[model samples]
Target: MKAEKWVFGFIFVFFLVVTPIYWFMSGEIAGTFVLGFSALLGGMIATYLGLTARSFDPRPEDRDAEVVEAAGPVGFFAPQSMWPFWCAITVALIFLGPALHQAWITLVGVGFGIWALSGWVLQFYRGDYKH
Candidate 1:
């Protein structure tokens, strides 16, 4: 985590220094904004990591331990389900409606999005049993 934090910190500083230099050289607004925002995001992450460092235990990677030393309790992942696909379709509809100037499509997409969200949240829920 320390190393990761430093890497992001470096990114923040590097982009911070480069953004103005880039703007002065190219005089382009879009690239300047991108670089500047990149710096902001990097700084945010580095700050977050730095602030939380005290609560975080040193991981195997930080100690340069073997990979097997870190192999434990990865995390929970949802089982297979079609809700994700349905959710993607709803997002497409949401964007497509505005793009095509059809308010009805966007409304439908929003409605379906609510349904998809509920279904996805409750997919693992089985009454009177472990989910």
Candidate 2:
């Protein structure tokens, strides 16, 4: 936690110092704003980490711990599924349709988005995972 705080703090300061120099050099508004926003995000992360508890138990990297010490059951992770990918495609189509001036594609995307969302949500309920 300490290391993370310092790292993000460095990032925040680095970006803060560079944003103005970049803006002065390039004379661009968008990139300058982006850098400023990046600095803001980094500062927020560093501040949050600083305010949180250091931790009751030290992390593995913080101590002289072996790989076997850390090796254990993590938790349940989802098995392979393509619904998320399909859902992303549907979102792209939804936005692309308006950008391209194609209403039909947007409608199709909406229909598919519903299917994707429901399929992802109910996948285990109807499948082998059901009990």
Best by lDDT: 1
Which residue runs does candidate 2 get wrong by more than 4 Å?
Answer: 53-56
**Lowest-scoring 10 consecutive residues by lDDT in candidate 2?**
53-62
Candidates in order have lDDT scores of: 0.92, 0.90
lDDT of 2: 0.90
Itemize residue pairs with steric clashes in candidate 2: none
lDDT of 2 by residue, 1-131 (tens): 67898899999999999999999899999999999999999999999987773645766865788988888899767788889999999999999899999999999999999999999988888776663
Best by TM-score: 1
Error in Å for residue 117 of model 1 = 1.2
Residue-level lDDT of model 1, residues 1-131, one tens digit each, is 88989999999999999999999999999999999999999999999988888797888877879989989899878767889999999999999999999999999999999999888888778643235
